[model samples]
Target: MTQTVPTPAHLVRQRYRDPQPTEPAQWNEVLRVLHEHRSVRRYLADPVSDDTLRLLISAAQSAPTSSNLQVWSVVAVRDPRRKARLAALAGDQAHILQAPVLLVWTADFARLRQLADDHDAPLEGADYLESSYVGFIDAALAAQNAVVAAESLGLGTVYLGALRNHPENVAAELNLPAQVFAVFGLLVGHPDPAEDARVKPRLPQGAVLHHETYDLAVQRAHVAEYETRIAEFYAEQQLAHSWTERVLNRLGSVASLNGRHRLRASLENHGFRLK
Candidate 1:
């Protein structure tokens, strides 16, 4: 028997786990791909080709940049031994080792710094916190574009924020220079079919989409509603987790940061003045 294809309405419903899902006004393959995204934890050992990696980088470059500064770059790691060492530093996530390529995205000012040094330019603005934020934002936008591109090509990806857990170690492992910080890691490869990961539900539209003015007063109700919906989502996966509890636990204390709380010091060590 052939499997049934889900309608656009069904895909939208699956995204939010909505009991009363309505048909979207507009729908296309891009929308479908964006909505269907799920983090693949298990992957096949099949290697990603250099051509495909270049294509993904091209797609990433197409994403909008702030002021056209383009202060980001990526290091694609495929060496098994190097990946294993990185995996050890990054919370020992098996997926990091399993994936064919680990793309280490960086908030890089090194390129601009070189240009400035060569021309004797001041580059005082690069030392400010705002400039750092721009680099970080630009890197995130680029990586997200790569994620969409990879998924569109039937490849799987999962972001590894744990790369920041030991920033100094990861920087050393990647041989990154000063003014270049490893913002995060992205694993890319063919997904293992056995895992069969489902779409993780998100909060209700009203909870996040604030019209004109922000409505802090009504967010509590939205959270309550989302709790019940996501509880069922968790139960289906045999994972006894609460979204609220997870958030609190993940951000409740300095211990909870898992060593990322020292990120300011790490950034400073990496030559960001953060003035």
Candidate 2:
């Protein structure tokens, strides 16, 4: 039996779960990979080799940096013991231990600080709140590229934002130095086909793709529409949840942040002046 492979545009349209998907104006392997992204929660026990990890990092490094500072670093943790400990620290996400690799991406400024110290230079700029944004942005761009590359090679992945819940513990577990904060943990491994996680729906184009100026008045309407769409997705998984309710609960109170509400104090403790 022969199987037909989907084109890049088809994959892109599939991502949105678009009811009336249009043909893409452009197509490439990169687009194909980007569109096929789905956060896989279950994984096979297969290992991801060091050579492949190196390739993923190469792809990450190829991403553009803010002012070429490249204030980012990644720790590829394959040790099951270490991964299990990290998983425990990060909300006990089972996938972290199940996956062969947990790539801990960080917003690293320790290297630059050392360089400045060596040159007897004042690195006052790094203390500003803006610089923290730059580091976070740089790390995100790099991680996303790695995600795309992994998907292209038929790997599955999921982002563990819960790593921030107990930042201090995570930093200690990873042996991170001052000024190097774990942004997130990425679980990378072969997919468990039984999970069959489909592409999650997204807000419609009209909700985000503004013509020129931003419009806030119509946002409520768009969000309302998105709730209906995502509800169907949740129903298919036999889960009962509301998008609005979930979003509200996620951010309605500081207590819900799961220790992340103390991030400012945590950051200060870690040497990020964030002035």
Candidate 3:
């Protein structure tokens, strides 16, 4: 038996939107699947089976967690009515309702807190700002693994960050208890061929990848180059907008957040002291 190795350069280029591409030194199905990822907004009506969902969660759980805390959980919403309500709360993303399943990944400490309470144990550490970061990071890592797993199985998935726009409503809809925050939603289903969502380009490697130390002096030039490269990508899709302009507008004002500006308040209301 023999195994093929993927070219590091090709992977790097795909991630960086480099105009000059090189042939991969080696290749395999896994690497191919990984590099081929794109967020799928439009989905076909085909259903994702229970077996596949289980496989996705298995892969998610397999991801590394800090201190073996495993402080993440996923709520799979299959009911159409419930999914619709969630979609409404989550910035009205239509695909969330269209997809067969919307997996709401959460940063969960409630389970551990319950266990600690059962034994009259103190979980003061879980209340710290550092611990909150751990929970969110752990959840993100696990969800990204599930995204890859879904893509490997020929399933399309998109992360709905907009779910946080109405975090309180989302939490209420999902019946999440205290210490369990809905990190984001992942919509999984068959991709609709008509949507024609292409691979969106990213910033050049020079902009993000720093050697041993960081350098801010070179950032302006890299961003300028990226503006041109990603422009072509957007043009192909018949969309018009400068990458910098989009990013700036998306975060330029608190209003652009579409209610996510209240995230800190929402988190506090959800029982995260953030102290």
Candidate 4:
């Protein structure tokens, strides 16, 4: 007997757990991979090969960069002791230690700065807040490309945003130079089947996909609808808190920033003038 394949409509339904989902106009392998994405926190002992890592980097490089400045770099860390220390700095996330490889993505400007200095050229623009944003955006785009490539290759991955919680320590551990800020870390490895991670549902299309003009007032209703829909997902994950509560707790106060409240100061200390 031939195995049945899932249609685009089915995948859409699965993505939102929507009571009524319309069939998409088109579908392909890329869409399937994107729709199936999930954060795999539990990983196996198996190593990610060098060949695969190179391919992932190449894929990342293929992502478009602003003015092709390519202001991003990635450090692949595999040392157990180093990973443990970095993990400790990043909220004690066990997955950092569990994964065989941790890729630290950085917004790098030191490379260009060195070139400018060598040529005796003024690099004043690098000190601006807009330039800093460009670097961060470039790093994010590159890392996301790598994430998609890793998932396509059957490797499990999870992004460690908490790496920024203690940016200075992470910078020291990675030996990052001034003007090279660690944006985040990504853990890549073989997933543990026991974990059985599921694809997280997202907000309804009406909540985000706006038309010619934005509508702020209708967002409350959409959020209310989303809360109801996502409640099922929360129950399945054994989580008691609602999405609103979780988000609020994350951003309710300065203390909730997990030391990131001083991010501006940290950036300044790291050579980002943010002018």
lDDT of each: 0.95, 0.89, 0.89, 0.93
Candidate 1 local lDDT, 123-231, one digit each (tens):
9999999999999999999999999999999999999999999999999999999999999999999999999988999988888999999998888998998999889
Q: Which is better, 3 or 4, measured by lDDT?
A: 4
Q: State each candidate's clash count.
A: 0, 0, 0, 0
* RMSD in angstroms between candidate 1 and the native structure over all alpha carbons: 0.8
Best by lDDT: 1
Each prediction's TM-score against the native?
A: 0.98, 0.96, 0.93, 0.97
User: Model 4 reaches what TM-score against the true structure?
Assistant: 0.97
Candidate 3 to truth, TM: 0.93
lDDT per residue as tens, model 2, 1-275: 89889976567557666566778887877777777789999999989998999999999999999999999999999998998888888888888889999999999999999999999999999999999989889999999999999999999999989999989998998899999998888888999999997888788777888777998887888888788788888899897879888889999999888889888888888999999
Over 1-275, each residue of candidate 4 has an lDDT whose tens digit, in order, gives: 99888888888888898899899998899998888889999999999999999999999999989999999999999999999999999999999999999999999999999999999999999999999999999999999999999999999999998999999999999999999999999999999999989888898888898999999888898899889988998999999999999999999999988999888998999999999
The alpha-carbon deviation from the true structure for residue 187 of candidate 3, after best TM-score superposition, in angstroms, is: 0.3
Better of 1 and 4 by TM-score: 1
Better of 1 and 3 by lDDT: 1
Model 1 lDDT-worst window of ten: 232-241
Off by over 4 Å in 2: 7-12
Question: Higher-TM-score candidate among 2 and 4?
Answer: 4
CA shift at 117, candidate 2, in angstroms?
Answer: 1.3
Instruction: Locate the minimum summed-lDDT window of 10 residues in model 2.
Output: 9-18
